[model samples]
Target chain A: MSNLPNVPFLKFIYKPKNELEKGGRTEIPAPRQSSEPERRCPNCYKSVPLSKISANMSMCGCGYHFRMTARQRISLICDTFEELWPGVVSNDPLGFPGYVKKLDTVKVASGELEAVVCGKAEIDSQPCCVFIMESYFMMGSMGSAVGEKITRLFEYATMNRLPVVGFTVSGGARMQEGLLSLMQMAKTSGAVRRHSEAGLFYLTVLTDPTMGGVTASFAMEGDIIIAEPGAMVGFAGPRVIEQTTGKTLPKGFQLAESLLEHGFVDAIIPRPEQKEKIGKLLMMNKAVN
Target chain B: MANPKYKSAYEIVKTARSGQRPTGIDMINGCFTDFIELHGDRYFSDDRAIIGGLALLYDIPVTVIAIEKGHTLKERTEHGFGAPQPEGYRKALRLMRQAEKFKRPIICFVDTSGAYCGIDAEERGQGSAIAANLYEMIGLKVPIISVFIGEGGSGGALALAVADKVWMLENAVYSVISPEGCASIIWKDIKKAETAAEYLKMTAYDALELGVADEIISENGLGGDEFYTMLKDKLKAAADELTAFDGLADARYKRFRKFGSYDEITIETEEHK
Candidate 1:
């Protein structure tokens, strides 16, 4: 009913009525067109058959990496994950209109109660606390729930003397929660500091499109920060920058390689090698700690 | 004519937002002597938006870091309108670390609309840079005093503001988001920025009441000889107080930990009613 035009694709994806009526417990049906055998890479505009991309963890041949859900990322990286604080859910602190409903839709679609999943896991026998941001859940924006989960994870790691590993993919702070969402930056950063003060290792693996408040906080506070090849990692998105500066950005402006050149990223590891590389890093950190 | 003594939140916002207001450079020059400018984030190109250096505050050694807004339009654009990119923050961190290593107290001048929100800024990890500063600053083993000189907006402001003692000039404003941004988000109208400014409680006085700022330095009608002298005296006193503390890192950690401390009470419905 609003004057703004409805996005057809989003409407199809977020059919809230059907999703909420089911109490967000079951998987919503994928869009009708997605039933086809091929899945297009949104980044490179290349279409690869579902089977091929699935085998490669949805990475395209042209080197564009599709986003992975937190569960998917954890499954790929950790040998075994015992999820922590699964009951921590979001409340609309600001009482923003329709926020709860939107959260329900995302919850059902992503099978995630919150944007991030934290757990104790082993990477090639190196035990560490892992937190994976679920990009599928509201673009992995940090709200109070996400902040609480991450803070608790850090505290848990500090108490147990375990290293902390974070996989970050976010669009920034959740707008629905307003200032409460912004406060997460400080809270998470404080937690990271405490973890660091304890002489525990903290590593962050930035994936495709990690931006906003998450980038500013725990994502960047890592003792060692690694990124996926060609991931967009920065504070502001390109479109916002283009609009603000009123100029076309240079090609590959926020790419992981560009960040590496800028000294923001330590290394760019491909998905195929991420598990091995992380395991090795954890092993090294264990020796140091 | 606008009343200088008792201005509304909107008036204060306008005055603080004015380009005529004194910038970080002005404060550094007024309060400190023998400044040696430092540059570069060492990771990438040096961001001119933030400038730092070793300086003397009344013959006492210190490091000065400031968000610089240029006087002219050309200068402003070049300086990114005082909004720091990731490199600017990294540069600040680099300098802060240097100051810590050399056992110099740090005096930071905040004057910016916010961090740069451009694609290139984000691509380079603007958030991470700001966050890293916050994470590192809380435990830095040196005295840090941050003064909000003009507009201090959003996490960009907070990034540089995690100090042992945070002071603000009388007319300065600090908030999680700019008034215009808050207005747009809250009311879906940018024109309601004045209302947003009032409700955001971003004035120096408001900050003092909220315990976010330690003191408010009254700059009677912008910067003058009197205002500068008072500011210098205050800075010296704060630095001296901080240096006297034995466990500075622990105190700094506790200072940031207590920020935004509050209590919540839930009302229960009466059974009889």
Candidate 2:
């Protein structure tokens, strides 16, 4: 440990093909066992995976492509001229039960004001209210603050006569605030009513583990519910439901594909296609916009 | 302590008049003269979440079917988390259809957010039960009066709330979803439920204005003890008055029809439409 050389420098010197020339003779060091490559694909062996074979397909050597994150989502839809609006946040109130303490701890660990990021942005420059929820914060649990922010945002859209796009990801109610936490569902639902009353457009996108309060309220209340492929969107989760029923759920029970076939979501939007479709919706609503 | 009881009906309306809110079963038991707790839907099983029975409110014989949002973990489990599975709603349906057969007035205390959304519920067809309730309850021959005491969520609450007159306690809430759920969707954070609360406009007052709830039950100097007592009395009085309504049954159907429509202007109007 005491004589360990710099890793980058040793990496260059230890190149097996580049042997050192010392005293008129070339000396090659034995290959390090640590240099062995990691897991290989059982299928057609390839090193660089995740490279797309076509526009809509991800060609992975292992035949596995990961689900997209919320950040990757927004950027994909709104590139170049995509200007994300300033975000809204939540603060604590109703020092009920263990809520105040939980919020304090979550803020430092999750580094976001609220789980959702809301602002004015465009799908191809369409003036719309965009809200994207981050699942990292307290499992994107919704409380009064989150509820009120969304209500105000909805109300703002209502007042402005703008369309709204919401992406949801959550575990369930905060549960810490008790009745106060339960109150948010009504609050946001009311805002949605006002928004709909104003003849404004609103779309809800459900994502992985989108259960509990989110599913109960406006997440499922949209005119057009959209979901990413394989996303789970329901009130109680599948596992909990399975445990309660004691029957094995059909494959992709609450998955986006299932929801689509069942007529819950209008489409299973690919990550790449999300922007274009939203832009198209914005365009359709543009006459009102 | 009857010797030292507070004087006047107003005094009885205190929060600690009883120290806690009355359970769905308890509320009916205390007010009614002959309380008979019935069980089960012949189709499947009984649901304790909704206690269906025969009772007399203010000397009037009636059938009561209530959506019980249970208290405590054990009660919650027993009540299926206060979310009526298909069986519970079906049980209520059986009772409702029976009430219709007897031409008895139906009294429903709604305190559930919605039908159980658990997997067992879905597999057993919770949505179908809820939809069936909405459909059948609307045309029941008997007069129906619904009281929103705690929560009235989605189809679960609606199963009971499809009544001639829907009344809400000053603090009760009724909505398609709860605020925490909305916040989770809109903010991606459940802790921001306070914000969700502010946004949903879910207060009884809001429902009253929106035509969702017909009237709000004024506490009238009430606290925990007498809250339910005063509420039950007021509810009893209200239900009695509704029977005098020439078109009470029609009113019930109209109330539910309001939730069906969605109104939104085309985006073309955003600029100049």
Against the true structure, what is each candidate's TM-score? 0.78, 0.55
lDDT of 1 by residue, A1-289 (tens): 2222377766555544554554453455557546668877877787788777877876888877877777778778899888787767788754456678998899899877789988899988889999999899989988878888888899899999999999999988776664456667777787888888888999999998888778878888899999998888877767767877898988878888888987888999999898999999988887344
Report the C-alpha displacement of residue B208, candidate 1, in angstroms.
Answer: 5.0
**lDDT at A38 for candidate 1?**
88
What local lDDT does model 2 show for residue B272? 9
Task: Please give the CA lDDT of all the candidate structures.
Answer: 0.81, 0.63
RMSD of each: 11.5, 12.0
Model 2 agreement with the true structure over A1-289: per-residue lDDT tens digits = 1222457677555534322323122243437434644434334555442334322333244443334444555665554322232233444433334445666677677655567666666677787887777787788877655665676688788877888889888876555433344445545665676577577888887777677666656686676778876677765667656665677888767777777776567888866567788888777765343
Model 1 / residue A154 / CA error / Å: 2.4
Compose the digit string of candidate 2's lDDT tens values, residues B33-136.
Answer: 68888999887788778888899877877888876655566776787656677788888888889987987788887777567766546545454465456546
TM-score of chain B of each: 0.92, 0.81
For candidate 1, write residues B1-273 as lDDT tens digits. 112368877788888878888888888888889988999999888998998998899879999999999788988888889999889999999999999999999999999888988766766667777898988887888999999988887778878888888888888887767778767866889998887776667788877775677888877756788888888998998899888889887776665444332222232431110
After superposing candidate 2 on the true structure, give the runs of residues whose Cα lies further than 4 Å from its correct spot.
A1-70, A79-102, A286-289, B1-65, B68-82, B86-108, B111-120, B123-232, B236-273
User: Model 2 chain B: which ten-residue window has the lowest total lDDT?
Assistant: B264-273
How well does candidate 1 match the true structure in TM-score terms? Answer: 0.78
Best by TM-score: 1
Worst 10 residues of 1 chain A by lDDT: A19-28
Give the lowest summed-lDDT range of ten residues in model 1 chain B.
B264-273
**Interface RMSD, one decimal, each candidate:** 7.4, 10.3
